[model samples]
Target chain A: MTEPHDLPSAAELVEAVREFLAHDVLPAVDGRVQFHTRVAVNVLGMVGRELALGPAQAAAHGEGLAALGVSSEAELARIIRQGGADDRMDDIGRFVRATVRAKLEVANPKYLAE
Target chain B: MSDGGRDAEPAALLRSVLDAPIENLRRLSGGASRETWSFDCGGRPLILRRDPPGAPKEGMAVEARLLRAAGACGVPVPEVVAAESSFIVMERVEGETIPRKILRDDAFAAARPALAAQCGTVLAALHRIPVEDFADLPDTDQVAEWRDILDSLGQPHPAFELGLRWLGENRPPRSGTTVVHGDFRNGNLIVGPEGVRAVLDWELAHRGDPLEDLGWLCVKAWRFGVNDKPVGGFGDYDELVGAYEDAGGGHVDRDALMWWQAMGTLKWGIMCIVQGSLHVSGTVRSVELAAIGRRVCENEWDLLDLLPYGRD
Candidate 1:
């Protein structure tokens, strides 16, 4: 990979803020503010994960879409809606589950394990 | 505080409503669609639920009436003290409604063994109530309604589309309609040390298939990470479904429950989309609401997990 610019990459920057909120801000707050702080931490955590994983996941997604002959999610969704997936149920199911797993990988990976 | 000073103070309004000075009026948390406040009026503990400034304004009366009806039918519920067009005052039932506490804490250990069965019994009792009196609540043909909602959002979620298609193809021959508690789940119930003390949130109460409530409860999201105990993360399906049958909920169809569980999973994902859109649309921007949009994937994964070919 190319180190185009500075010290803190996008993922590192998000991790720093996420850690600050989790360690510094969370302990001091209570109730609604604390809850929102937790959510903010999770949001940043997701951002960090997306930054770190988005490129590889995007490539995998593009491959999966190509295998199914759909250029994009919207296109696949349209096909599924029009009964186009009936002929290729196994492939479509595999693609959809893989796509959802990729999403869960970033949004909340704990759900994937469950 | 975000009402921009246009609305009158909550305390002042409560003072006139109860004919006494309100005391210890503090806002409680966690209802995305409505405001929840805890307070005391003339030495009586109460909770105030009112619509926020620009949100919808007419569910309070409907909810209040449903509470009264449910309470009369032996379904535990908070006693509605008063009901106005935009707000409803009710006695504050003390117990834990948080799923994490109920799922993990030793405080509810004795309560866990019976929680799922209690949910069964409570739902059965509520479903027995006549629905003719409360006929105005929103009713939808679950699969098509949610599909339209996703369509209008204009974002394609193939996982959601698959779930919707499955639901439409395999709907249970419309089970007899009953007064279903639209959002009955672990999070909505006030659980005392002994058992469930009150069932809260009647906003989605409607005349629908009785199995809808049961299936919705079994949705994995409500489990709060306790996936093994499929009945709200506490008990197994045998205890729940058996209790419902034993308690006179009629012949239980196993396949139908699976259908509704998938339907419920799909509905929850779409609701997250709607909730997340509220933040993006600038209607009610908040970190909490925006964060919910990301949680939609959790529901999508669960929906796929429900598919027949799913790998364990």
Candidate 2:
């Protein structure tokens, strides 16, 4: 199942770019530029994590929505807002928590760890 | 050349209004909606907080008056010297407002033990400010207000919706109305070795339930990655409530505090979406705002943490 194209995958490429910014570009800049660059590196790291985890997370969310008899997250959200799912709040909470945790895994794993 | 001296308009405006020569006028960072210029007026350090021209005029004047009123009541706040139509000249109390340093830095170590209670005391004083003095300030139902804002964003967030639904279902009895610091948190307070030196950022001041401030302070977002300590990552809930009581603040209901804390978490989650929308809509186009968009999950997770129905 391996279709070899490049040595560095997309995630590795992003990691290398983030490393360049953190190691090479960050120290060379100062003030606002440096600050924004650091933020950019963080964003890139998040991107890398998302690339690695997004597909599985999306599948899990889709399955969760399907389990609640909603085809999409929007439908699930509408049901929650209208109190249509009030009787199943425990189920809804578990679904929402799992979905949000998946997001935190990419956005900030340290948060989930804590 | 620095962006500080790029425009002489500020210096010229100061000279015209204050009748004094200005020196060392520089712009301080971090005001999304307003301009903050720090300068010396006749050898005295002062801050010029001004809204952009053609913007609404009354907010700054109202803020200046509010700071004055809060300070007069023994609340730690910068003194307002003079306020024009769109700006305020105030005595600048120097201190650090960065949340991370205030929570973790060695310099603030001595201040940590007393910081949360002090925050409670200061908030108590702020809540005691006379409401009749500022008749223009409106008392808003925060649950309704945040729900409306999230609705206007036109994005469906199930977690936020769940939180709002819970808040609507568990409406707390109104305890009484007072002046509420709409954004009372670590980032807004200036801290030094002693404790809170000055409470900055009065733009969000309004008359509402004082518990809103307490709940907002306890929001996990303000904890700055330190989730264990509930009161701004520096002190516990009992310490805060005890100090508030000792400082003559009214008694707060525990359930009400929990409800407001969940509401505050949902409010911040919705705000992250709104902030990200600004970037997506190509209005402001800021990386910082774009990055904040990702923080929506943090608030969502925190809301689940605070919500009572499903917590095991």
Candidate 3:
């Protein structure tokens, strides 16, 4: 049961992870610790962002795409690969937003290392 | 790892300019098309940017040209000191990347408007540069660009296809063209006490519709989780637009900005997919790189929602 307020802000989580790695992880590592640090920090930051809004963002995107006659994640994924949407009469901005939103959902769980 | 082969040329060149001996060199993560490194030369700092192995010979030259163009335009960009086919030596700006810090900090929420406004102003200035100065640069046609990018990836995302078709049918006539910063956003800006110190990574610079830069800044992907606040999650949409207008960017229509924003997200999504494929196929490997590929879906979904046709 994660309450809204209980959830760490993306920045907070990222900072915590960054601090831990710098103080704890780096001192213990042997080869190319700096390289590992950069990778870890970057991934942490990205994960924090995803944790903040990935699910809601994805749902919003899926809804928008569905409105454009795209129903499933798989279908939307295909449309994204093709690089265009079906509807021309509609606003391009709105269509792009929805499409990106849906895609964000797919990446969210992946970011958490799930 | 030490610089092998021609990669050592930048350090050698830089050593000639600086008084100190080169101590250590390490590659910094971020650039996909080029190699970026931070090195110590006689206890002083320097950055080396070079084309990756197997990159075309012309790539470094193009980068130099774009950096020169950006400097002429009054953009806060790194000064290019020297360049060759293998590498370019430049002064590195000191600051945390805007995306790396600003997006996650609630303390910086108040500064969001200011940051976004600054971004707008910077973009407006970048766009004001004369296109003819970079005449040999190729123009990116929206439809053709999308098709080409998708074909290159070989991943059939229906959302992308739909987006391409929708954009083709609904493509707005180009309002005006200028020097476009193809990827202007939070991650690319180096923010310091003096405000945005430098706009780094000009590899994608080109001559195209000015809105391309605007759209890229406002793209949801760059929002870094603060999607509610437009302008790279720093401020409201109106504030950013107003800042650009104040900076002498003439006649910006909100509708036009929105259109560009969607396009920006779509383009980014495709790039992510392509990058992801590269990682998956073993062309490159790294958690961050693979993660970026996974992130493409978010951009695609964002683009889908921004367009009217996708509305319920």
Q: Give the number of the best model, judged by lDDT.
A: 1
In model 1, the runs with Cα more than 4 Å from the true position are: A1-4, B1-9, B15-21, B30-33, B53-56, B309-312
Top candidate on DockQ is 2
Question: RMSD (Cα, Å) of candidate 3?
Answer: 8.6
TM-score of 1: 0.92
lDDT of 3 by residue, B181-267 (tens): 787888888876445778987768877778778878888767777767777777787777788889987667777777788777778
Candidate 1: tens digits of C-alpha lDDT, residues B282-312: 9998998899998998888889888753343
Q: Each candidate's chain A: what TM-score?
A: 0.94, 0.90, 0.53
Per model, kept true contacts as a fraction are 0.71, 0.66, 0.55
- Model 3, residue B105: C-alpha shift (Å): 4.4
DockQ of 2: 0.69
DockQ of each: 0.66, 0.69, 0.26
Ten consecutive residues with minimal summed lDDT in candidate 2 chain B? B1-10
Error of 1 at A22 (Å): 3.3
What is the alpha-carbon interface RMSD for each candidate? 1.6, 1.4, 6.6
**Which segments of model 3 are wrong by more than 4 Å?**
A1-114, B1-10, B16-26, B30-32, B39-44, B105-111, B286-288
